[model samples]
Target: MFEAVIWDFGGVLTSSPFEAFARFEAERGLPADIIRRTNTVNHLENAWAKFERAEVDIETFDRLFAQESLALGAEVRGKDILPLLAGDLRPEMVEALRRIRAKFKTGCITNNLPANAIGSAGGRTLYIAEVMALFDHVIESAKIGLRKPDSKIYRMMVDALSVDPAACIYLDDLGVNLKPAREMGMTTIKVVSARQALAELEAATGLSLR
Candidate 1:
């Protein structure tokens, strides 16, 4: 029933940045999940959201995020979180994408910062570029000024892919991002772990993902 498979780049294709966030928080002696809390507090218009949409520059985001976190009882600099966003790639997930791409149209939608945002850009950029090349089409929030959980972005992908929502299968680590696709008639899979997500995709696509 599905003609296309859509993926979210960050948490789905790679190890989650949230794991890095927790480690940062623990090392800093701040409250657990504080970074997540700050990001979620004013989700749509917050510093993190603005950065992803390219509405704010790195310095501006750093100041704004620090202020936002201070208000929530911790003063974490935004620049500190930038390095944490570059998670190690999951080999199995990358292999799965290669297999799936041979049979179905594949697309990636990611909410990301500018290329220069990362502290060490050389290796990271090359690795990400390699993975990104596997997709037939890729949409980035920083490049497009639209982030996920916005139904418009989801519509944009289906429109770009030239596929109806009902004929697409979407995978995202965030339930908030998946909800709109699911509502629009796409089969949605919420990725918790690589193993679990692959199993779910296997059932949905009737392919041996693992």
Candidate 2:
């Protein structure tokens, strides 16, 4: 049903960041949605969007993210929490990506920070290296100044992969990110669990990822 597959790096390819965020909240006694709420401070113009767009440097993002979160409640030190965001890679997803790439063009569209910004500690560098080797086209928001859920980034990914929206299926953990891709006529999968995502891919492309 699709000629191309698009993957989201942090949550879909890797274990969901929300899991780590949950651990952080439990450990720190912070609210459940503090991190997400902080990210939505200015909506599209929030610190996260700006950082992903490369409009703000790491230092600036640290300040802005801290300020935004502080206004809500707890004082979240962006630097302290940055390392926790690099969730461990899902080996099954990596294998599935490789299987899909053999028959379909694959692209990775992610809203991520530059390594320099996040300090690249906690095995992040190694994780990225292994997974990046699997993708044919990687559209990283930090590198491109375009974040997901924005219609433009979705267009950029398919065009760069030499495919059209209708021929592509995008998998993302966030509904917000999936919205624009679906609106652009790409088939969409909301990747809530590794098992479910693989099943969706199998149904979409007739590939036995399991």
Per-residue lDDT over 97-116 for candidate 2, one digit per residue giving the tens place of the 0 to 100 score: 98998999999988888757
Query: Worst ten-residue run, lDDT, model 2?
Result: 115-124
Candidate 1 deviant stretches above 4 angstroms = none
Model 2: lDDT equals: 0.86
- Residues 1-210 of candidate 1 have per-residue lDDT tens digits of 889999999898899999999999999899999999999988999999999999999999999999999999999999999999988889899999998998899999999897689765558767878999999889999999999988999899888889999999999999989999999999999999999999999998899877
TM-score of 1: 0.97
Off by over 4 Å in 2: 121-124
Task: Indicate which candidate wins on TM-score.
Answer: 1
Provide the TM-score for each candidate, comma-separated: 0.97, 0.94
State each model's C-alpha RMSD to the native: 1.0, 1.5
Alpha-carbon lDDT, every model? 0.92, 0.86
The 10-residue segment with the lowest total lDDT in model 1: 118-127
